[model samples]
Target: MASSASSLTGGISAAEWDARVNLAAAYRLTALFGWDDLVFTHISARVPGPEHHFLINPYGMMFDEITASSLVKIDRDGRKVDDSPYDVNPAGFTIHSAIHAAREDAHCVMHTHSVNGVAVSAQEAGLLPLSQQSLGVLASLGQHDYEGIALNADEKPRLVRDLGHHTYLMLRNHGLLTVGATPADAFVAMYFFEAACMIQVRAQSGGGTLRPIPQPILDGIKQQIGQVTRGVTPGALVWPGLLRRLDRRNPGYAD
Candidate 1:
């Protein structure tokens, strides 16, 4: 982890600093929950300054190894703007930058390729609303077919078009992606999404009839998430606890 530099002290605002911390915490927690794919998938937050920059994990670091200071700041073009020892992954940022640039409502975007997520993505049926956990995602999910590799700049427009107005998106035959008004919202969305995939995979393995939640009940589930969560927004409420968990397991994230 890089030591905090006094020269860069006043560059990022308080709000941006908080966003960086929460995004870094989410990366560590994703690793803790066994959702990371070594160092492949990424979670990013928009930097809070005038440049409309964003923060992403350094290319070579494991998700659990990401720290707030270690996170690389980059322009929408995926060029590193900060003087860090690490390099940003341009290919990784291609998908992330598209969403952040198009959606002002999205402050944080998370992408993962956990076994269950990719397993379900590979399935012809995709996510089945067979469990209560699945309803959370079904309420506002979208699908995007896989294009060979996301590194192509030409693919950005299509990717953004497919993700229009949806919180959860299954990248068919690829993995799962979620966008949030805040980092916590995005994380919670992915949590339910990954859980749904796990349940579906397990249920399929049993070769038993799958009882799915009715479409009528989905509204109620969404309402409950909004109500019980105190309208605090999913990301804001859970982010602090995630940070504390990281602090206990690997305190270097804040370094």
Candidate 2:
């Protein structure tokens, strides 16, 4: 088995190291916010190397428990090239790889099966624009039908097509996924997406007629979010605070 420190530091540039730390921080925050589904879901970031390789959590580790050193590096074919005792989740990679291979802009990808996310996904109407939070996510969201288990290589093409040019994706009967130019961007997108789902579910449970946001107002809000949030990039102002919180709770993810 590869030593944790060597596997994480070896062959990784400073930029890659930064990415790994940020992605690891995202996993910790996601778990903190109750978005993790134990060891079931994943998030991945492209390593800043010639091979276009990526890093993902070791299969058995819960998101909260994933350290930067515990993340596994793998090629596009999902073969582990790093020395680690843990195995990679092939199904997790299938969804992430589809986007990374197809969209050069996607440097990081995150997926979750949180209760609210899956609940909204199973709804026939899917993510109604009932709240401001939902509108923020809906403006940039795309939907893809769930194809049962994502183990088949053949599903990559369709998955890529469905996620075309969108940052957030609602997997029908499955969960939520988001892509970003950086790990922070992906995490922010998922944060908003998950919030939207949670709000929708809670509102629906109140047993009242839903009031959808006006289309013109919704469009305006979308523009405002883009302008104010600066293209919805996650590294904006919120990420640093999140990282600090992680450090306080769990310290460095690198082992």
Candidate 3:
């Protein structure tokens, strides 16, 4: 395959094809939530192998226009490993590649600069424990201070250091990033993360005394989640419904 629309498989596994569909769906879903920063931020999914290859959007395409077959496969250095007509934004790949290199479980990494996400990032407190949505984010969140544009390779260690074992990373003065073993998991985490940021920004603008949730409640959020959803995987339950919704509205992502 020469990396046209038919490259959705391109000698990849059935699992890889499914990953492509989900990753493409995620791109469209980002558009659905209006979280995309045009062609700036990205969502990358690692191909299931020891080779460190990953799949990212074909640059120059809007998130909503991304398709399963059109994603470009690239290496850790952000160089294209498979043929594609699109040229990737190397600077954008820096952050994604850094996280993918650091976290083995982070098969899927999503970054966004949505209004609330960037607004929350600029806050000194960095995602306060106010709303229940924030509690979900607070459960396993890490924050990294802004380091200007992500064009430097030296930022990788610091970013990995700041991220540590946390599932979510809040880039101070930048935006939100989430990691998941699957695209759906990352998508679900980001949904909660963005919602939390949106709620915090709205609450702060209300011009009233703000109340942070008690620390004890924050600590028990994970346990509470298991109870609330009966321990079902967070994304697994909701992802199908999301795809159905997308199918009804904009159905080309799976192509």
Candidate 4:
């Protein structure tokens, strides 16, 4: 299987092939966790080395169906740089391209429209610090107000500006977005982001007075996160387990 997977890459660099496998896993895990919104939202990864190339899902393929070999390679303009049967998504292009161009550290960008995520995004208060999961997100979160369908090239500036160094972005009345140095980092960040929204929605449905985590505690989340993960990104610590879980439940993302 490993040899077969490598054969599908057409002799790309080992680093690029690794990126493709991780990106494919991220997509499968997103669907595994029920974060996929049909085939609408996207998750993209920067291909290793210079040259401003990226790998995004083939348009119309469900997240679970994505494989490393199936992800399409494209340039910054969302045009295919290699031979592939699949096309990229335009809205995905507008959003992912801007971040990939703007942020050097954003190696992976993930966006999803999960039910709980969209519900919390619709709230004026946005993601409140109501749980431990929320603390991780709140520590580096930003909110971007909805501006139609994100199809316009004009929305890119404001979207990037709103994201502005934050790891988590709540697209108002839209969805959730997260960026990281790798697919693992981005996927883990989105896990917390989505979990935070899910907890908030469930808590709100109870119709009781909400309790926000104290401001000082929220202020220390970065330090706490560092301690909890023992000086590594949470993704690094957990991604292996995530892949193991995927292997047990929905394997073949590496194909």
State the RMSD for candidate 2. 1.7
C-alpha TM-score for every candidate: 0.94, 0.95, 0.96, 0.97
Instruction: Give a tens-digit lDDT track for model 3, residues 1-255.
Output: 225446456677887788889999999999998999999989999988788899998889999999888888899999999778998888778998998988988999999998999999998889999898889889899989898999999999998998889989999988999999899999999999999999999999998999999999998999999888787878888999999999998898867
List pairs with backbone clashes in candidate 4. none
Task: Give the distance in Å from residue 18's predicted Cα in candidate 1 to where it truly belongs.
Answer: 1.7
Model 3 Cα shift for residue 62 (angstroms): 0.1
- Cα deviation of 125 in candidate 1 (Å)? 1.5
Error of 4 at 185 (Å): 0.4
The Cα error of candidate 4 at residue 169, in Å, is 0.7
Q: Give the TM-score of candidate 3.
A: 0.96
Which structure is stronger by lDDT: 3 or 4?
4
For all candidates in order, the CA lDDT equals 0.85, 0.86, 0.89, 0.92
Range of the 10 consecutive residues with the lowest summed lDDT in candidate 1: 1-10
Best by TM-score: 4
Supply candidate 2's per-residue lDDT for 41.
94
Displacement of the residue 156 alpha carbon in candidate 1, Å = 1.2
RMSD of 3: 1.5
Of the candidates numbered 1 and 2, which has the greater lDDT value? Answer: 2
Residue 165 of model 1 has an lDDT of 91
Question: Candidate 2's residue-wise lDDT over 112-214, tens digit each?
Answer: 9999999999999999888877777777788899889899999999898888898889999999999988888888888889989898999999999988888
